[model samples]
Target: MYVTEYPKGDVDKEIDKLNKKLSRSFSKDATQVIRKLQKANCDALGIGRHLIAFYPNTWKEKDKNEYLRNVKFKTNVDVEIVQVGIAE
Candidate 1:
């Protein structure tokens, strides 16, 4: 599921500069993005068991791990981070 706050044209490309296949979506900000993904997983409409998130290369490792742990706790799904090398 996509959960970034970036503009439509910039979302996927921002994370996959090499034009690789990556699963993502755009939202309004960092906070709402995670909430939406969690909601999607529990909603009537079924979503996938895996989620892919994009992060900037400059992100602190601790923060990254924390976010991953939080997502799993909330959604109980697999979370993967894709590095864009640039902060959002």
Candidate 2:
């Protein structure tokens, strides 16, 4: 994480809050990307591979190539600010 100005109050707490907000933003973006991919019937994430390997019966029940569109995706993102770069 890089900041032009250091947080004015409670540096640690502010960084933590920023991290949470960033995580949520990233997760939302990921979900949007996933939806776009599913709409195009593009399994760029290889979700089908996991389903076929572990849940063969479930995979068999859906249309082989068109199943992703109907699948539900739960996305979680965690962000960590390992190094905070402050410009001089």
Candidate 3:
């Protein structure tokens, strides 16, 4: 997922817009996927891991979840469909 934003906008509003966009894009199976990931205690987004990689010292001093809670994420996904079969 990738996000491009206007240089000057309300940060929280921009984040909300991005979240809504992502939710719409992944609406079909998003709930189920979220439930499964939460149940498994998995961070499929790699957010924690990425933070650790980029800010090892800071990560080592703080809880990953706490850090995650303070960070904002924006994502974009592209979907392509190909080869629809004839109905029986």
RMSD of 3: 13.1
- What is the C-alpha lDDT profile of model 1 across 18-57, one tens digit per residue? 2233322221243466666655444222222122224334
Q: lDDT ranking from best to worst? A: 2, 3, 1
Question: How well does model 3 score by local distance difference test?
Answer: 0.58
- TM-score winner between 2 and 3, please give it: 2
Which residue pairs does candidate 1 place in steric collision? Answer: 2-24, 2-25, 4-27, 5-27
| lDDT for each residue of candidate 3 in 1-63, tens digit (9 for 90 to 100) | 344444666434566665665567786466566556656657887867886889788779876
Give one digit per residue, the lDDT tens place, for model 2 in 1-88: 5544665665465888878888999999999999999999999998889989999998888898788898899998888776665566
Candidate closest to the true structure, highest TM-score = 2
TM-score of 1: 0.18
The alpha-carbon deviation from the true structure for residue 12 of candidate 2, after best TM-score superposition, in angstroms, is: 4.9
Candidate 2 stretches with Cα past 4 Å from truth are 1-13, 86-88
Superposed by TM-score, candidate 3 places the C-alpha of residue 42 at a distance from the truth, in angstroms, of 5.7
TM-score of every model versus the real structure: 0.18, 0.76, 0.41
Report clash pairs, candidate 2.
none
Poorest 10 consecutive residues of model 2 by lDDT? Answer: 2-11
List where candidate 1 sits over 4 angstroms from the true fold. 1-28, 42-88
